[model samples]
Target chain A: MFGFVNANPKSLSEEEKAIYQAFYCGLCRELKKRGGQKCEILLNYDSVFLALLLSGLYEPPENSFSFKCAVHPLKNREAYENEFISYAADIDIILSYESLKDRVHDGGALAYKKLLSSLEEIYRSSAGKYEDKAKAAALCVKKTTEAEEEKVSDIDILSSFTGEMLSECFVRKKDEFSEKLFSCGFYLGKYIYLLDAYYDYLSDRKKHRFNPLHLMGFSNMSDMTDFTEPLLTAYISECVNAFEMLPVLTYSGIIRNILYSGVWSRFNIAKKRYLSKEQKK
Target chain B: MDPYKVLGVSRSDSDDDIKRAYRNLSRRYHPDANLNNPNKDAIEEKFKQINIAYDQIMNERKGGAGQSAGRGPGSSYGYRQAGFSDDSAFGGFSDAFRRNNERQQQSDGISPEMQAAVNYIRNGRSSEAMHALLEVPEYERNGTWFYLASVASQGMGNMANAQNFISRAIQLEPNNPTFREFSERLNNIGAGGWYETGRAAYGNPYGNNSSSSWCADLICMNLMCFCCRC
Candidate 1:
């Protein structure tokens, strides 16, 4: 959930965008409700996506209301409250806390460790609610970090760990949908992990750090993408395939837009930048 | 089922339209593309139906201008009539995986672990197959080692890992058509790749040489320099 999942704003209709924003504000409000002002900053589109997906899948009663916030001081924002949003918010805290813990463990500056400890009280409260999910998330982080330290050249093995984490988090219920939900999270997580590596290749090269794509001998951006784009396409296709199996009708228009087009927003922009850089050289 | 109905085309629809529909369906339902799908028996069946429909349509139009011009449907549509049953073209994972290992053992002695891994893969014990493969010393791993690794990973539901391993296999044995074919089938690259499937699924009926995309890319490249001031 490293802030990579997003809906393409340009692709969404005005009404659809507003609907998405309502969920966004609703998630923000939920975060504030849990950990007050400091936790609001952790509000992200990925968590909002989980909330939207679960909401669309299960038509839970929404506690709708108009709320005023500093972001929109003059106008009251249309906000929604539901069990899923609260659930997503709890996951948001647990994941955020774990990622911070990873950075601090990775010999990050003292400030990061301080931040991790600062969020502990909030994290413990949320993590205590879903011990299974939190433990699974932490385990994946540990496995992924260990793989990175070992310089595992097989990126598939490296990314699979992160994918496994999402696979665990996606299954909130045990039912017919669990298998497909598990698959959806796995592929989505792979796409996110690999795309993150794709964007960081240049800096990773500069620092002489490990990058899976670079290790594959694709020194140039075009070569790297030529190697990567098909993999990403296959992954996103599988993710959408699993998503289609879920019986989700309401808010599906917006959710489909995000899954289909929005998720590619960052990849497209990064491609243009990297390709243009190649041209400049 | 009527060939036209299967292809979602009609006699009134031009031969081009029918062929295009056939091309899209074939790629979408290709056995190589859906190696990871658990319900693969159905896909292979659907692929057969698509092929039969396409051949039926093509045979009906055998004397058309395309046939008269010596351009076979095989080349233009990227369909291989032989590929339908050929081990090299659409051998799914197990056959493809086994064929390559047999070829490797022909010239020299294959490590016992490599042979064991192949048997394990054939028997649907990919986890043990992977462990057996790990027993092979790193120095002795040829393209076949990487190739089998990819197949084992495929069986274990580690698709992305499978793709990269096969790609490495191809890098090690670039000219080995079997390795190249395995890489293409695993990663969905080269001819009948994922991008082609994408173009076929989306509205681009003409293929990658469409004037619209060519012009768009040209303009984007030109404008990138002018606008960014890098």
Candidate 2:
């Protein structure tokens, strides 16, 4: 989920945007309350997407509240709340905590060492709720960190770990749609992982770190896209294929925006920046 | 009757031995073999039982569970459980899906293992197709082999392998229309059927060669305007 998935703002209307924000704010409040200020810092649109997706699928009871948040003390905003929203927050909190554990074990993110026990206390209370998701996140985080350190560059295998991780994350409450949900998350997870790699290619190159596209031997961004684009599209297309089959009429429009176009927000930015630089060179 | 018991083989018997038993039982007493016999009704009933037993046993083996006993005649969904149904637009898959077992004749000079792989793929058993393809000796893998591998890979949710395999098929038999058509579909699958709903230039993520022609990026323009990021 790596903080990359986002809804494209230009595509949404004022009302739709507010609706989206209501849920986003709802998730933010849940995160802050459950995982504390440090955990709130880990809030991302990816988790919000998960929440909204599950909500769209299940259409759980809505719990709307009007309140002034820490960010908007002058104006109280109406936030929509639901069990799925809280579930997403717990997921966000647990994944962040697992990430912290990974950093500590890998002896990276050293600054977070002191906060581990505190986050662990929060995680202990929350992990029980979504034991499946926590276990998957913990294992995937550990494996992903290892893949990075060991420089495992088989893109499919590397991406699949994330796929499997988020696949578990997607099936919050298993029903007949669980398989489709898992497939949706699996391919979308692969898409996000590949997109992240492509976006970080130059930066990782400068740092002499692992980026799967590096193995493709692209002399320029265009060449890299030639290899990555089809694979990426294939993945996201499979995601949409599953998404279409899901009975998610609630946020289908917004979810379609994300699946069809919004997910490319980062890619658009990364490609333009790299191409323009290459032209200058 | 228990399919294994009807077939006169225990579950412990190897697949080949069971298959041999079915062949022998069906051959001597098959309806076609007993056209003029006085006991034709009983023979036909016995033949029907033999067919059902074999199908049930195969379904059980394919699904790896005992619950396959009462499934419909075909276990097509067993393979599709991997997600992403094979595009039936490809010409051969429909016929393959309709195929009954006992197709060991290997028409068109295809290896028996490749034939088996095709049947597995037809039934949506991609992992089985993969195994069958792997069983084919390397010397016999033709363009059809690579093409079948692509189909099986796609069924298994391994599109990377599917793309790679179909490309190999094209390279080996460039003029094969089926291969060419499949390659085109495989390359452009996800982007199709999407542009109709999305007004944004979603087809090409990087936009066209013009660098600014990407008009599909803003689909669902009235939905919302504040998708938050980290």
Candidate 3:
């Protein structure tokens, strides 16, 4: 669902890179187990992190299975069996479905449009299984699409909508720890929206498309990095704070490094790179 | 909750130790550091608790000393009380966004150019302020330029010139407390105002007795120009 991860090559240390790959593979295994091979492509780091978090939080029923992916032919793969991973898989389907629907409505190109259309049945079935998450994701995407169409200026409203949807996913099994997880999701949702809005700004401008920052009349994206950096800093801090709440599962170390060092620094450096590229152009 | 214990201090710890403890704890549980930690809810709750504990202990100690001195007594303690139910301070300050129409209304029918000048002043963009101020209509140029000049002069550390420009600001905004404060602060640093301690205006507040009337005359001359226009 988060296309930005692939587009931006945020460098990571060897250890972090290995953890990320393992998580990515782990997510692939999860999607396949939950919804079959068709859902494997729906796997991404965003959902992987969510899976890892849920695993850490709930201690999933068991950590079981091994396999190999086309991406890593010779390597052994591990799949975790748990409620959180299952939930993450469901969410991935819901988000991907809604995002696809948005793209179709927004006039996405042929292959992408077709792929999303083909996945609808599977998405609908998964949505049926996880009704609340599906509903929330659908509602958030709908609101975001509507705001884009209407050209709304309060970017936080749409960002919060996305945040609330993710937050809702965690809030269902409410407890002291989940509440912290919800808060983390809330700010991270805002961070994601800001970054996506920023990365898409120039292209959106060229295509006569809507960007949240553009709606606010911020001419330069870096100008927003100052405003956005604090949110990112807060996002990382929340992740750190959430760490204490985590029950310390199998992949806790992997998740922590990805969150604290990888995602944090990537977001921190992205604006600088984006600005310099804009300057060069 | 023992406030001293909350701050990791003994009851006999010096004021400096207490301050240091508060600073260290504040940095550790600061909302910025733990943005999305799964335990953010607990951290925030703990943070609020720590803040309250520290404040209570510090205030009790300060109050005890102040009571002994009997100086500035009976005044309301402005320090934020922890027992208060309001969490707005803990949530962080909100910058209220006034809608464009409301912003225009607040500018008193000022042209967009003049409004931009004022915004530049508030944002510390003096060059931009000058650029925008120049765009004001000729009829309104005097007031706009003077206000912009006051902000620019103040930013540039030319207090005398700043006072001159501020007097012009007073002519335009007689009842504006902010402008009055600016004028008052400038006057205090020069001839003498409330900020001057143990010296009357006539006694040469700058400590050079002969300098009094000269500085006072400069202020009087500036105010006269402003009064003449008013």
lDDT of candidate 1 at residue A100, scale 0 to 100: 80
Candidate 1 lands at a TM-score of 0.66
Checking candidate 2 for backbone clashes, the offending pairs are: A11-B221, A12-B224, A13-B222, A13-B224, A17-B224, B79-B124, B200-B216, B201-B215, B201-B216, B202-B216
What's the lDDT for all of these models?
0.69, 0.69, 0.55
lDDT per residue as tens, model 2, B1-230? 88898889999886567667776787677777799999999998988787667655654553342111111111222212321222222334544433412232354466788878877766656788889999988877878889888877776666788888998988987776666766666665543434224526433243232122111222122112222210
What DockQ does every candidate get? 0.06, 0.09, 0.02
State the lDDT of candidate 2 residue by residue for A164-208, as single tens digits: 888888887644456667777888888888998988988888977
Q: Relative to the unseen true structure, what is the C-alpha lDDT of residue A176 in candidate 2, on a scale of 0 to 100?
A: 41
Give the runs in model 2 whose Cα sits over 4 Å from its true position: A104-107, A115-117, A145-152, B1-92, B96-108, B191-230
Q: Between prediction 2 and prediction 3, which has the larger TM-score?
A: 2
For each candidate, how many residue pairs have backbone atoms clashing (under 3 Å)? 1, 10, 13
Q: After superposition, how far is residue B23 of candidate 2 from its true place, in Å?
A: 48
For candidate 1, lDDT tens digit of each residue in A231-274? 77766665664565455667877777666666666676678789
Where is the poorest 10-residue window by lDDT in model 3 chain A? A3-12
Query: Which CAPRI quality tier does the interface of model 3 achieve?
Result: incorrect
Off by over 4 Å in 3: A3-21, A34-36, A219-221, A234-252, A264-272, A278-281, B1-230
Local lDDT at A179 for model 2: 65
Runs in model 1 with CA error above 4 Å?
A107-111, A205-210, B1-129, B132-148, B155-161, B164-184, B189-230
